[model samples]
Target: MTAHIPQSRFAPAEVVTRPQPGTAPTDRRPLWTVIALTAALTGLIMAGYVLTIGTWTVWAVVAMALITLTTLTLSLGAATAVVGLIFPAPRAPRPMPDWQPSSRTAILLTLCGEPPRGPAAMLAELAADLQRAGLDRFVDIFVISDTRDDKAKAEAEALAPLIGSGAITYRRRQENVGRKPGNISDWLDRWGGDYDFMLPLDADSRMSARRIRHLIHRMERSPSTGLLQSGMRLLPAETRFGQLQRSAQRIMGPTFLQGFSAWTGDAGNYWGHNALIRVRAFRDAVPLPKLSGVAPFGGDVLSHDFVEAAWMRRAGWRIEIDADTRASAEDGPQTLAEYHKRDRRWCQGNLQHLRLIAAPGLHPLSRLHMAVGVMGYLSAPLWLATLLLLATGAVPMAAGWMLLAVATLLAAPKLCGVARLMRQARGLRTKGVVLRAAALETVLSSILAPIVMVNHVVDVAQVFAGRDCGWKRPGGASLRLPTGGLEALAGTGIIALVAATNPSAVVWVLPVALPLVFAPLFIRFMEAPCACLMARA
Candidate 1:
């Protein structure tokens, strides 16, 4: 039953304890149709704007260019997603009739500055679940730390006795090296020889042992899948902003991910955690090549998971998500300040993907993934440009109609998702709940959007100026009124200009401006723990 790959520097002790599983085959022809449709929709909208405007002034040209780019990016999330919802893909990999894995799987908990008690306690509970399923023998837990904090390191070392003997092991690096990717790569170099699969989980991540077994079984049925990602839900939160995001995610996240899965098929992307990876495939194919030069776009890649998936696929492997499984959950940043901190780091990391978009020998889909990552952050600046032009009367008034069309396109995916969810639930009760949640989410998000936009603009500017954000844990603290107002100043200035130039424009501009004007109050209200608890009750 045990199949072993040839031992090399890539995996000195690699062993396949199980027979190679069957490859999960899929037809991807429909994906292209969806892509073409998305392109056509974006082009038609752009053409409508330019033709209606009937002028090509320098400012108009810049605004139109921004509009075109932002629309194309938005279309991927909206119009094409709506198409995928309308015609969903075959369901994700499920348990095979009589197949079981013969391989040992390592559950890696990568930590950096986090206290050990949290992950250790989670694993201890998981140990009991695995024991109940009689799968204890096939799994082991590893707490890999890159914590520079002495107290955190000490706390992690002290938890060894609590986790018991061989069921768990603790290891740390003297030098943090390439951040998270380095910590994981180091483990593979040292301990990867013993296991056929690795499930990398973030410190905040949790998944039941039954689900873990199911994931392994699914992988056993999917020989070609280099990595299998799971849908992660947000944990129950105790803050208004947290609750808002959680509600939005509950309503829309599955549909969004399913649509992505439909288009991606075998070329699915990898999130950093809540995923399983085949040892040999990852070891050989994803060696974590260092980018040339220094920080930002160069040196050690900030977003290693996406690039790793691309590298594995380049070496002939498939990546997929187990959409049917959704028990995995993690805590999110509770406050807007914390969210901004997290996003700033992500913005820099995503922007760095520009360097890899055209890397030689990449699959076209892989290239598209990189380009999408780059645009996720780059589009913010483009959006900012469009707003500035519109507010200053530099663009045509017909731009208002184009904006209306864009808003419709943006809402299409959510509308489709709710419709699909209603159908799947097969009852009016679920539909009512979804609608109520959607309305509340829309209101909360409208306020949050301007704050996020301004933060991303600053983050992108800093990254472009060669400023290294580096990695830091998010401190989930509510901002005082002063700090919050400072963040809102740019939006305040824009609103003032809009009010002075054209009173009629205030209605369209209020959505963005009102959020910024009252951002401090919004943050304070949403950050109130008591209010959050009352709302939950």
Candidate 2:
């Protein structure tokens, strides 16, 4: 049973005591189907490696490497499952102390460029919702403006009275020192010491104030945890593309988190915001490194969260992820232009990890996670290159089969991933809903996949190659930002091409291509908001 009438302070509907027992979530297909496809993927990959290597001896080596990889993967998974099973995490103890301190939780809203609505609307929505959660008095809000633009400063000033006396704090800097991370670091240096649990708000992120309270409740109850990273949900229902992406994430994100958190149990972590944190621990542990260099990844880690997590880990404090925890929500870029703007920055940040992929401190799994994150973005281009190169009548027919087989290897993990998610989603009555959405996302992802792959690869490749990737912010914030052009076209085109794989050996096989193509669109809009709460929850 789930709560249908979500709590909202700005507009609270009477808690209509209603029962909405759902249909037994649909029976997802057999595990074997996925396993078999996985094997096919492996064989195909080995075939490619052998074809690529030119000699039988090299083929033998490749064969050994593939075997090693497969074995290692299986062993790691088995070990993790065993560990979790042996030391199952304890749930929230009864009577989670209503740690709703009257001292107030600060809603820290930091802004760079006025992206869509100047963060006020987001703050208002979140503030109202949080107030309804019986946290208004315990809530102190702040909107940090780093934009040196006089007009933007004036605009923020105009928002002062609306923000309410002391309830909201609008601090604008005449000289913006630390970009975003710097800004946050300065805050920590100056005022972060004041609050018990500060809720960090990004320009794009939004959440139910109730969610924030839940995070605080969890934190107060579990004193050792330093930070809480909430399960993220994208906002807005603008384009059809965004909706598709958000729905898929809403459904799968929790399960992924469940597995992730379960794995990180004692060694938990944080994701900047959408969750609450023990400000003291974060201040003591995570600090913006005195990075001296140029912009993007150079000055202070572009990927500050991972580094901060790593820093916390190094300090022997466990930073865990509650994959099941629902604490926050945020929106993705709404349009193609906006999407790529975000992508470029992500590429720079992820690639910066190349230096630490072999770093000493982090849990081995965190290392692997970071590596995979980088590879996921870069792999697309390599995969695309391999396919395009093979597709051309350039290589020998034998080479083609070899490449096809190699390509198959790459598909194995994804197929297995789909299966794992499905299994976790056992007894899903919404299989059809999930599958339909998955199918749509797949086709959409396919076309855009190439573009994103190449785009990210090139950006990272430039960084690796020591070429400058000039930072260019795209699409200013407004009531209506650009939407539904390149991403939709690219997504639809990509999905259409990959649709052939839908009624395959495995029912969920279709989603492999879904997220990539449709991410720009799907992630931008919140799809099936209500359904998302259920299946995704």
Best by TM-score: 1
Clashes of each: 1, 37
TM-score of each: 0.90, 0.69
**Candidate 2 structure quality by residue, lDDT tens digits, 317-342:** 44656554454677765455566676
Model 1 clashing residue pairs (backbone): 13-193
Off by over 4 Å in 1: 1-24, 89-99, 426-429, 473-481, 500-504, 530-537
TM-score of decoy 2: 0.69
**Candidate number achieving the greatest lDDT relative to the actual structure:** 1
lDDT of 1: 0.75
For candidate 1, lDDT tens digit of each residue in 1-537? 111112221223343354333345676655776688678889888878767875668888888788888888888788556655766557545565544567778889888877667777887887778777777778877777777756554655566664445556667777887789888988888788878889999888999877888889877766777898888888877788788777777767777777777778788888899898998889868777788888877888888889999998888788887765367888888887688778878887887888887787887888888888888878877887787687667775644676687777767777876777777875777677767767777777767877878777778888898878787422222223375675567768878887887666767777777888887788898776635332542
Q: RMSDs, each prediction?
A: 4.8, 11.5
Q: Return the lDDT, model 1, position 13.
A: 39
